[model samples]
Target: MAKTTTASKEGMAIRTKREIIKLLKQEGALDALQLAKLLGLTGMAVRQHLYNLQEERLVAFEEEARPMGRPAKMWRLTPEANRLFPDGHADLLVSMIESMREAFEEEGLEKMLEIRNRKQIIQYLSKAPSDLPLKEQLEALAHARTAEGYMAEVIDNVDGSYSFVEKHCPICEAAKVCSGLCSKELEMIQQVLGEDVDVERKSHMLTNSNRCVYSIKPKGSAVL
Candidate 1:
């Protein structure tokens, strides 16, 4: 068996830190004890990583009030931590969009986006199951987005609807340069999800939020 060297141990620590960040990103907030449980590590080990992340300004914590002795510390990712995820050649995409606009004007640029939107709709439709339950269909949609570096997931809402959330937008910069890209995403999602359901944009990433959320449900009925 290969002996673990100092460098290898250090590498494991680094990987643990990243895993902590991913968990926080997906689950929103968690206490050190909770993180330790989920990661199969001791609380002390988790807290050490959390403190390092805090010092790096990649993570922060707020105290949650408890009825018992002491309040619990709930850790969450800081906005700066968003850099760790992929942005899908954001700078290059943004430059290409600007070049297209300058060469062809707004109308031509919109036309190009429309073509891209049509392709995107077809791609999503090809993967998302039309015959499954609305929630399961949304799960498939989320899986497709995740494969495209969107870090997407579906959540069950209390009001009988599903929330499809994209934690990271790989084309965020490009989307900002061309608002139609953002609208097209919504339009494509609506079309791909089928006419039997309604998809509503709830939160937007460009509006100071780090995530985009959409409320989806069957038309004139609950999802489940």
Candidate 2:
């Protein structure tokens, strides 16, 4: 007979919590029942973990209306939980931007933004080629963005259009100080997708939306 060892309670709890966070990041707000179904755990068990996370201010819940009854509690990661994900040295990046602004003013800052965009365009183009189908290009671009801590994904509209969503922005703090950083990202995407493709910023986190959503479709068609 083979003997099997079970994970320690503490270790299991930690891993489960991380999984919960990962699911929420990928799928957005979900109720305990949804989470339980996804994680294959009892709803009670998931609720316990969620309550614990709520106490830590890592997660929060809002009442979401359902057609049948009272609103269900939909849970999501709090902004504080952003620290648990890769941040790409947010503080240092913000500091560098501030220092550059002090030394060079708006003109110098704009120049730096251009330089950074050129480099990012090169890197992004290598991953996502315009020749590929639009869906394939988005997947490649999302992969590259996720690798850089953007937590990006592509959403199929099923009507010959797609949505490029970035759930979290690792350099959000830096972007806040330098709006050009935000605009240049769109430029990079435009350059990668080529002129026939239309990439529009539908929603932005800086505008108080939960995430950044870009409407992408071929030119000469409505953005359904």
Candidate 3:
């Protein structure tokens, strides 16, 4: 049986890491093979992820005795990780709208007056050129998204799939419904490509103590 845990939304820079924490929080502990099989990732990939998580101080492991080999490392989510994600509420756009409403309430018509300026602020600050490689562009966009409070993380699956993990949903958390943050995320994704890129949304947090595996298969290449 696999142990599970719920990952909090704090300190979890990526959605994948958050989902992994959630799994570890709920399930308790999982071996590498179990993590690989459950999350649909290769063992080596899983190990790399585990190492990263460990470095973040989000996960710990014990050397468990095996039947015929040396003791193997079994990973577990720490309490700190559980505390980070809090509840799995993804109120993305709703939160954004609520924030806008609050600002409007305080600023009144001034809010409307400031909207274009705010837009200009972001447009001026965003220096992501369109000439970079798709991967590089994605990384730049991911950085921007993270700065804007999306908890975005970019993963190069090494298979050609670029996994963008959304860690926070201010709208979802605030409005509870009537928000299509996921759609907006997809739209941003489309802007980075000339042709139709195979952007897939796993609809899972990448942080919670559990593995949320995804691949980026290159164009005309076999999917991993």
TM-score (all chains, Cα) for each model? 0.86, 0.92, 0.43
1-224 in candidate 3: lDDT tens per residue? 12222244233336556666766654558887887787777888778778889998888999999999998888987645644753335445446555665766535534443464455335523644456676776677667755665555677775567876655433334323322333443534554543445665566443332422222334666666
Candidate 2 residues 185-206, lDDT tens each?
A: 8898888898998889998978
RMSD of each: 2.8, 3.0, 12.2
Task: Please give the TM-score that candidate 1 achieves against the real structure.
Answer: 0.86
* lDDT (tens digit, per residue) of candidate 1 on 8-89: 9889999999999999888878999999999999999999999999999999998999999799999998878877888898
Overall local distance difference test of candidate 3 = 0.57
The global C-alpha lDDT for each of the candidates, from Candidate 1 onward, is 0.89, 0.89, 0.57
lDDT of 2 at 79: 83
Q: After superposition, how far is residue 118 of candidate 3 from its true place, in Å?
A: 13
What's model 2's overall lDDT?
0.89
TM-score ranking, best first: 2, 1, 3
